[model samples]
Target: MLVERLERFFQRREEARRRDYFYVTEVAKCPRQIFYAVKGFPRPPLDGQTARRMALGDDVHRRIVNALYSLGLAVAAEVPIPENGLFHGRADAIISLGGENFVVEIKSVHPYQFDQAVAGPRRDHYLQLQLYLHYFDLQRGILLMENKANQELKEFLVERDEKVIQETLDRFRNLHRLIFGEGRLPPIPDKSDWEYDQCRYCPFREFCLRDATEPPQDTLEERDTVPSEGAPEETPPEKEGSGKERPAPRDPPPEDGGMEEILLFDL
Candidate 1:
């Protein structure tokens, strides 16, 4: 009964539809998928497990923010970056530490990902934080990850890099022109993009693949696209009669179970 009630409650979620500005986290994902979001394309509704996990993360995120606020560490909580006509997002907090203020973004992660993050912040998380720092004009940012299973914490420090920020901004700005300004979409998934990994979970898989049937007219060179490296590879079929076939894309995240990290950043 509780499961049914919870499912019904979350089913009413209507916010996932579409928007103009890119969420900070979405910028770090497959550009094609992000395009789908901004264009207001149809996608499968969030599954029950995924919805439940988000609810769990919300509870944990709120409680943690309150605790951090009380500790004198947080100068501000749930701070939204002023959408300077490009990107939109909320930092978990602006935290004071060692005489400096850092834009802080927190996450609820599975143990598997938490272990991977011990080396550094997860790729998508850092990308989001990097934007937070650049747009906020802050000197540094913090990525605080909590393991949902056990409440263990992993923290990463990120310093602002103008080079990275500029590259990212240029990329988003171009997409904004095409998506918003020109009413065009980003290019089809490049072979290196590991679109294979992303297609399964993508809301616009059929839409993308169908459009991809035409001759490739990629606006950005394949080399210009950043390679994401996290998903497991499955060798795809060779393209008909074309010597050039796409390699399995390396960077879109498919959850180990159903805990897609990207969903937390979804609207």
Candidate 2:
């Protein structure tokens, strides 16, 4: 059984390499529909404590990019990670200069927790960029954010810490494993448990209070999946007069995974 599982895992990994099955599987396994009830809660803006001082919209992220350009960094917008099955993530900017490739995730932080929480969200982004490094074998990543009005960019050393990611992949190898993986959707905190100001901006708040309706489920579950690894070959149809054969469709290369960026200059 162990050998069979190992064989299946390798076969799936090879399929992911040849045809980007990771991307297809991740999209197909997206839990947005499954988590609708939990996601339907309202959270406040990043700077809800200060009236009229909150950072709203894309302006905050744009400013950080401008700062990088001024510093002579070549930025690539909306990089796709096909290996992990993630799509066009607007990487604040990607810099490839001075013989170094830098994938920067832009953010803004709340002033009070600026020092403490700055690295929390970007850790995932850095890990994601590291995955991109694996797919193309690049090195180095940077998490850039607006520190007050300055772009505070910190360089991170990408390491080969495949243990956690391997665990995640292994869990995905079987339906039963994935359904009961560690940290499967943590418990949601109660209203009093949350800060007073942080409850207004949650996308799901209305749903939590039964005050609004949710988007249709069919729309969220419409993603397609890759063909089964080691699928049996099908006999080709005979051509008309020439008796020629048609080619099978080829798969695209895989990309990386999801990213969570830091925003809010105050933090």
> What are the Cα lDDT values of the candidates?
0.63, 0.37
* Tens digit per residue, CA lDDT, model 2, 1-267: 686565444342111111222321222222321133222222222222222223231466666567657776655654554434322223456776666676655545433324444334333344455455544455545555444434354333344445645544453344323223331432232323222212222333333333233334442332233333221111112112322212322221111112333222222
Per-residue lDDT tens digits for candidate 1, residues 1-267, read: 698887776763222234567777675566766665555454455656666676787898799889887876879887888857887677889877777788878888777777776457766677788899987889877777888779987676777878888988998898888877886767754645332355445555655665442212332233233323111111112233333335545543334211123221111
* Over 4 Å off, model 2: 1-34, 37-57, 83-88, 117-136, 148-160, 168-267
Superposed Cα deviation of residue 208, candidate 1 (Å): 1.2
The C-alpha TM-scores of every prediction are 0.76, 0.43
For candidate 2, report its TM-score.
0.43
**Candidate 1 C-alpha error for residue 148, in Å:** 1.5
